[model samples]
Structures are given as structure tokens and as C-alpha cells.
Target: MHRLAVGINYPAWAGRNYRIQTASTVVSGLGNAAAPIATAFAVLGAGWGTAEVGYVTAARTVPLVVLMLIGGAVADRWPRHVVMVSANVFNAVSQGVLAALVLMGHPPLWTLLALSAAGGAGQAFYAPAAEGVILRAVSAEHASKALSVFKMGMNGAQIAGAALGGLLAAVADPGWVLAGDAACFAVAALMRSGLTQVGGRRESGPSLVHELRVGWREFVSRRWLWAIVVQFSLMNACVLAVETVYGPVIAEDRMGGAGAWGTAMAALSVGMVASAVLMARWQPRRILLVGNGGVFLFGLPALALALGLPLIPVVVAMFLSGVGVTVFVVGWMVALRQEIPEELLSRISAYDAFGSFALLPAGTALAGPAADLLGRSGALWACALTCLGLAAAVLLVPEVRQLERKVPEARGNLPQPEPATSG
Candidate 1:
């Protein structure tokens, strides 16, 4: 494996699926940008407080945690591209309707809650299917590049989306942001239409429980995988919960509000974009260790927020943290694509999502109460420290610290990747 190939040029052979993925990513990025603003819009529009914010966040996420395995199973059993296209279609309709309602008048709490859950349902299927597609979309040798291209598209799109979302929220109506999200989803669906079907294997058993049992076997077999996932579970509970639900409220009260927060988010994306470029060329020797260590960066902004630091410091923290996020993501994908069996990939990924995300709602639900009990600043500090500690603790696992990348040899069971076609 020549490391130099990573940095020099885009692999022209990466194929039509890669092109479709990037195109779909553009719209997905746009929607990601708008989604947060839309949530902010809902909270502000309803004159809701911290608890409301947490609940709205949970409404979308809880379903993803619950349904992710089934989603993964669908991806593994059905044509991966079909699953992706369907999920995107669901997102378009759900957001489009929500936007219309928001445009007419202030939407009720129940409406926002329902719409968020609808969004979650789309994600439940889309996330794993989207990933599994890559296994067939590009070859094992090009895995890093394929993922880099995909992630690069996402970050670049999100940056533009976040900027636009903030502007729409502040200058215009957030309903427009929601409308924009619907349009993005529509475009993503169209882009995904071109993707070839992948994941030909059907579960050997008919029962859903049997399918889950097989998936769980793959998930737990890799100690390193589960170890890192456990760390993220805790991190999401503490760091993510505080950052998503509580941090925004703090920004509104202390900083310049939505616009300021948007800029901060963009700073994060900027870092992510830079890291993606670097990752395209660079493969680490100890990927799991690197990934595990990179999570410390997430604590930076949280600590800054807790301390009531200036906006610039928080923005900088977010920016640096974004780089860490990109590292972990790329490394995780590389490790999984190289190490896991294709027949089991989607289901394993789903299980990973399930464990990693299972506690998110609990964390979100707890964040507000934790704040009430500990004070906002105190809760933020606690969450930040807790996550930082977990990040470090994961490194103590020998499997994670020592796992090295293996150049893949021809393996049985999984179908071979087709020659990467020109776009």
C-alpha cells in the first residue's frame, strides 16, 4: 500500500456510485445545516425552554437508536441503494410538510415533536444503508479515498448549509430553512437513484430476532470495535447532550444568539473540511488508538462554554474539535471496512449505532435536569470532564491501542468489489 497515492490525486476509477454519493451528500449536507436551525426555530417559536429543547432533540434521536438495527437489517437484505433512496424520499416529504405548516403559522408543540420523529425514522434506515453501499461502490483498496470523498462532500455541504440556515433563521423565517431542507432531501433522493444495488445476502433465518442475534455476534466479536463504541456512548451522553441541548440555550442568552452559534458550528465544519483533505492521503498505523485519542478535542468547546468564555474561544474550540471528529470517523470507517465481513457489515454497523446511540435520549433528558441541579455552567463543566475522561479511558484497552491496519487479502463469503467505474 503506497501512502503517497492517498495525497496525490483523486482516483478517477472511483466510479458512478461515488459520484452519486457525492451528489446525494450535497443535499444531505444542506439538510443537516438546516435541521439544527429548524430545531432552534421550533424552540424559539414555541417559546419553549431548556426541557423543551432536550425533548425535541430526543424525539428525533430516540427513534434512530431504537430502529437502527432493523434499518441495518433492511440494508443488508434489500438493495442498499433502494433503502437509501426510500429514506431520502421519506425525509423530503416529512420536511416539506413540516415546512408548509411552519410557514402558515406557529406550529404546535405536538407538530414539531411529530415532525422530528419523522426525520428520525428516515435516518434510521438511511445511515447504515448509506455506509454499506460503499463496500460495493468502491474497492477495498480505495476505501479511504471513497470515504474521504463522501465525508468531504458532507462537510463542504454542511458549511454552506449552516451559513445559509443561520441567515434564513435570523433574517427570514426558519420555515424557509425547513423548506430548504425538504428540497435538499428531494435532490439527495434523485442522486441516490443512480446508485447500484449492493448487499445481496439475505439473513439465513426468517425471524427478526435471529437476524439481530447474528449481527450481535459480529459486533461483540471485535473487542476493539465495541470498546470504542462504549466510549462514544458515554461521550454522547455527556458531551453531546450538553453541547446539543444546553449549549445553544446558553449561546442565546450569553452570546449573540442563532447567528453566533451558526458561525461557531461553521468553524467546526471548516476544521472537518481540512481534516478530510488530510485523511484522503494519510492512513494511520494505529487507527483505533488515533481515533480514541482524537475525542479529547470534543471537550475543548464544552469546557470553554462552561467557563463562559468569549465566542471566539468557543468557536476555535469547535474548529479544532471538528478535526478530531473527522479523524475518528475516517479511521472508524477504514477499520470497519477492512476488518468486518460484508454480509455482516450493515448489521454490525447497525448494532454499533444502537449501542453508541442508545443512551442519547437519556443524556438529553438528563442534561436539563442536571443543569437545574448543578447549574448550567456546572453541568457543562461536568459533562465536558466526564467525556474527556472516557476518551482517555478507552485507550487503556490493549486491543484498541495495538490494532494495526491489514492490507486486505482475498476473503471468502463476501463478493469481490467490481472495478471502480468512471463517473
Candidate 2:
């Protein structure tokens, strides 16, 4: 096995970016880990009904859909480092407020919704800026490998944070987990403050609406890009529906309970970490082909659960599915980074995010009802079938398959990218 050296002399900026990225990954992972437990406690421990929980979760998506593009625009207009730092700081404050509320035994549904909205807004701003900074940090030739490294760090943090959150939720107060999540954000903000902005100042942009239009155009121009987006949207809808509701329901019935679900999730995370490490060493050229092909296996866990497979078989399926997701994510990021211009990269990235995530809430909302009507097993099977179909659909695009033919150059004379206006 050949070890690929990062190659470039470690820039002072790279160190700062690496620290910031790592801290941010940890913080984001903590928040993600806390969310499920927090939401569960809000419903179970604090006496909030499922309807209220549904409302809060649904509300979070509104801001994500409405403000994500704006967040990208802000990242493009301001220094990426500044935007990221500010966003993290805001996130920390929001999480702190939520923790205080929960600890006080006054977890109002409205208050929870508001705090979640604030956090979503912060993410809208932070994600695009962070992605833009990553583009500037590494040379183009190393972009694919760099993305793989980033995924490894991000997924590794998610695994650790989620596992820690589960442990804390089991043994300690849920408020403690929320507080820890807040602390992670504070550290992320501090680390981000040290990063130097790359590529100098951005051009003053046209009206936000105009910039948004440009981003949309860039997004839709590529057949392969939109095809994957369509596939992912459908896939996400199916997966979200099953994973959010039916998977746990099935686990409770067939396995033990939430603990079993957590174990399966942890297994998935381990697989993701392994996949990221593997890709960092061996970047496939036809990323879309490789990614989508791998994604065909993503439905296995749901299928295994739907079929009432033994616990070990289900766990193994979950791990394999996690590997598929990692491959798909890394491949997608590399393709986007290589093809898109730096200026518009953040906005375009936001657009991609928006498109990919658009259906998630719908999926969540429908999952419970769908399970009620179709049965948990039926819903899980549906998700598996959808994933397989989507993967097959992505293979129809020639661009996705041919992307490997174009070896990425170190730096190209491509036109400066336009900033994203809408999220």
C-alpha cells in the first residue's frame, strides 16, 4: 500500500485551517449527536407531545431552506474565516441557551424551535464558508485527496461525538450533552479565528438576486450534477423516512431498543471512517461512477431489517451501507471542487446542499404516518428499493462516468467563480 504524501510544504494557513476544520467538525458532530437525544427528551422527559416535536423539527428546515443561499452569499462577500467564526460563535450561544432552558425544566417547544432555527441559520452561514476555505487551502491536484481527508475527520468526529452523546444520555442528564455540544462550538470558534483568508478579497457582487440566478444556472448546467441531486433527493427522502422512524421502531421490536439502534449507528460510523481512510489513499477518477455504483449497496441495512435478519447480519449491513455513503460523499465533493470555480464554489455548494436536503423534512414528516400505513417493514423495504433505483438512474449519465478522464490540474486559468446569492 503506497502512502500518498500531502506533498505541499505545510503552510501556516493550512495549520490554521486544519485546526478550524477539525474543531468545527467536532462541534457540528456534537450538535448532531445531541439533537436526537434532546428531541427525544423533549418529548419523553419534558412531556412534550409528538406533534410538538414534529413542529420543532419541521420548523428547523424552513430556515435551512430559506436562508441557506443567503448564507453562501454572505460567505462569498465576507472573509470566509470571519463568516465561519461568527457562525460558530452564534451556534455556541444558541446551544447554551437551549441547554439552560432544558436544565431549568422549562423546555418550551416554541423556545426549542427558535433555538433550533438559530442554529440552522448559523449552519447555513458556516457550511458554505467552511467549504470555500477548504477549496483555497489545498492545491487542485490534491483536491480529491484533501476532500477524503476532510471527510475522514468530519465522519470520525461524528462517530466519536454521537457515541459520546449516547453514553451521556444513558448515564447522565441530557442537558449535559447539550452543554458539551455548546462547549465544542466555542472551541471551534476560537480555532476558526486563527485561519488566514486565502485568494485575497472577493469581487464586489451584483444584487443578491442576480448572484443567486448565476448560482442556479451553474448548478443546472451540468446534467450529471442535477442527475445525482435528483437521485440523492429521492434517496435521502427514502432513507430519512426509514432511518428516522422505522429503523428504530424495527430495532425496538426485533432487537432490544434504542441501545441496539445506537449500536447499529456506531457500526455504521466505524465503516464510514474506514471508507474515508481508504479513499484518501486511492481516489477514483470516475468519482460519480464509483460513488453511485457504491451507493447501490446502501439499501442493504434497510433490507436486512425489513427481512428480520439476525442482529449481527443487520449490523454488518449497516456497516456496508455506511461505506457506500462515505464513498458517495467523498466522490461528490471531489467532483464539485474540481469542476466548479472558486468564486461561485460556496454558493454552488449551498445550492447543492439545498437541493440535496430539500426533501429530508418531508421524509421525516411522512415516515411515522407511512410506517403506520405501510408497516415498518414495508417502509424499510420501500427505502431500500428507492436507493437501488436512484443508484441505477445515476449510472445513465455519461458525465458522471467520464469525470475520471479529466485529471485535475494544480491551478487552472478558469474564470473567477461567482458568489452564491440564495441558499
Candidate 3:
């Protein structure tokens, strides 16, 4: 593959497994980006409202949160790539069936919820296993660069997916968009199946309970890690509530509906892609301290929506928020892969995901009711404020404020990217 001229050096040592992992991520991200938007609009198109949309989306997350630990243990016990492939296959089947149902007719709300829950079950297994794949494939020294490239590819896919999903849903039926997502999942599964030499060596025959207990210990051992995870629990809850439920409601009522929402989401993905490219070359000394600053931006779009801002401003806010989220994620992943032992990485990651997502289902479920009680704008305001507050509070921990980069730029075999010079 040809490199970009942006001075972001793709890791030379990111060989077969890493390449396959990145390919699968990029392919899957296309579907992942579009699926929620299509799902929401599909429900609305079915003559259902925010409550039904919330219930269906929340159904997906409930299984993911509930089975996260088990999924982590399974990943650790088996080959990570195998686990990922299996999960993708399951997701493809679930999503394909949902798409078919929608195409056939309106499809009952119960079917939508059930199929969504099934897809969530696949994701519960896929996430932690997939997290370990690229890190395991690349050397520790090159992990950051590899992750940056991986994220950039994923973000790029989302940029296309969001843009197309919105336009397609607006013109054609949302069912067609859902069908495309199912196809993406199928393609991703095929790509992932080729990955070898992914995941770390593990001891055989440990009980799932025993594995989870060990993971919990590693998770809580780091004060900064757990604190940040707690912060994201609230932060993510708010994000999900808005993205899956309230944001669409706002877009439908005021903005131009699916197309407008999709455009904003596409802008967000473009911001993430830009940030990932920047992160590949820029290494900040105080990783978390600088990274967490981006968290403040994460609340902007929600705040804008809550205030009934116009589409243009909301799209701009989404873009800024995307940049912030990408910075935080790249920094967080580097820290985890650097500090945590490879053997325990998947489980610890599982714990991290579990904590971060613990409240997400409730957030989605309550979003509709919250809108009713607090008023739509009032609920959005609450979510936005809670996200900003949690981000600020997490910074109070000294470890989070003082954490430094584990590997210096000069030390890594991958050379620092050269700056472009003007002629």
C-alpha cells in the first residue's frame, strides 16, 4: 500500500496479522458507522417514536455489557482472530436477517429488538478480542504507530459510510442501508479469518470466573485506569443516549432528518481521521493530561443540540468532538498496551470496556423517558453537562495528570516522521 504524504509513517513491522486486522477493522467500521443511523431511522419510518428506538438500540448494548467479561475470557483462552471472525459471522447473520425483515415489510418492533440484541452478543465477543489483535501482531515499540494507522483506516471508512448511509437512507429505504451494513460485516469476517499469529500465549484450562477475577485485580491495581474508566462510564452513557436516541429526534424535528444527521456524523469521522494522522507523528510528554483536554470537546455537539442550534453549528461541534475523542482513544490505547502485560491485556481491556459501558444500556433505555420527563432539550442538556463534569473530575487524580509516554519517539525503531519542507 502507498503511504500518504502527511508524514505519518505506517509501521514497517506491522506484517500479515496486523494488516489483516486493520483490513477487517476498516471494512467493519463502514457497517458499524451506518448501522445505528439506519436502525434509528428504520424504526421511525415504521411509525415508531423515540421510545421504540431507545428500546431496540438498548437491547443491543444490554447483551454486550452483560457478557463482556465472558467474552474477554473466551478471547484470552482462544485465538483472538478466531474469536473475532466468529463474532463477525454472527453479527453478519443477525444484521442480514434484520435487513431482510425490514425489506419484507415494516417488521414488528420485537423482531428489531431481538435481532439487535443478537448483534450485540456478537460485539460483546468481538471487541476485546479485536483490541488485542494489532497490538499482539506488532512489537511494543511500534504499537503506537500501528494503532494510529489502524484507527485512521477505521475512521476513513466511517467517513464514507456515514455520508453514504445518510444519503441512501434519505433517497432509498433505510432497509437498503441496513442490507449494506450486513454485507460489510460479512466481508469483514472473511478478511479477519486470514489473520494468524494474533493474541498472546495463555495458560490452559483456567476457569472463566478465575480469569475474570484476575482481570479485575489488574484493572483496579492502577488508580488512573479505573478512575478514567469510571469517568467514561458516565461520559459514554451520555454519548450513547444522544447518538442513538435524542440526536436523531432533534435532527428529524428541526434539521433535515437522516441526511442532516448523517452529514454531521460524517464530519465527526473526518475529524477523527485527521486527529489519528496527527497523533501518528506528534508525541506529547503528558499523555493523559493533554489527551483528557480533548474530553471537553466531546460534549460540544450534545450541548449544541440541547440548545437547538442550527445544523451547521451542530455539524461543526461534531467535528471538533470527533477530534477530541480520537486523541483520547489513541493516547489511552498506547498507555494500555505499553503498561499492561500482553498476557493480561485482553482481560484488562474487557474490564475497561465493561466499566466504561456499564451504564450505557441504562442511558439508552432511559433516554426517551428522560426526554419526556426533562423535555427533549432538557435531557440533552443533562447529558452534555454530565459528560463535561465527569471529564473534569477524572483529571483530579494525580496519576492521570502526571502520566508520561512509555516509549520516546527516538527510541522506537520506527523513525520520527519528517516534516514537509517548503521549496
- Name the top TM-score candidate: 3
Off by over 4 Å in 3: 1-11, 200-204, 410-423
**Worst 10-residue stretch by lDDT in candidate 1?**
408-417
**Once model 2 is optimally superposed onto the true structure by TM-score, how far is the C-alpha of residue 339 displaced, in angstroms?**
0.7
Alpha carbon lDDT of each predicted model:
0.80, 0.73, 0.87
Better model by TM-score, 1 or 3? 3
RMSD of 2: 7.4
Give TM per candidate.
0.91, 0.86, 0.93
* Whole-model lDDT, model 2: 0.73
By lDDT, highest first, what's the ranking?
3, 1, 2
Expressed as tens digits, the lDDT of each residue in 132-153 for candidate 3 is: 7766776666655777888899
Q: Which candidate is the best by lDDT?
A: 3
Task: Write the residue-wise lDDT of candidate 1 on 204-306 in tens digits.
Answer: 6567678778888888888898998888887877766755677678777888777777777778888888989988777777878887667888788889888
Span of 10 residues, lowest total lDDT, candidate 3 = 414-423
| Candidate 1 backbone collisions, by pair | 6-281
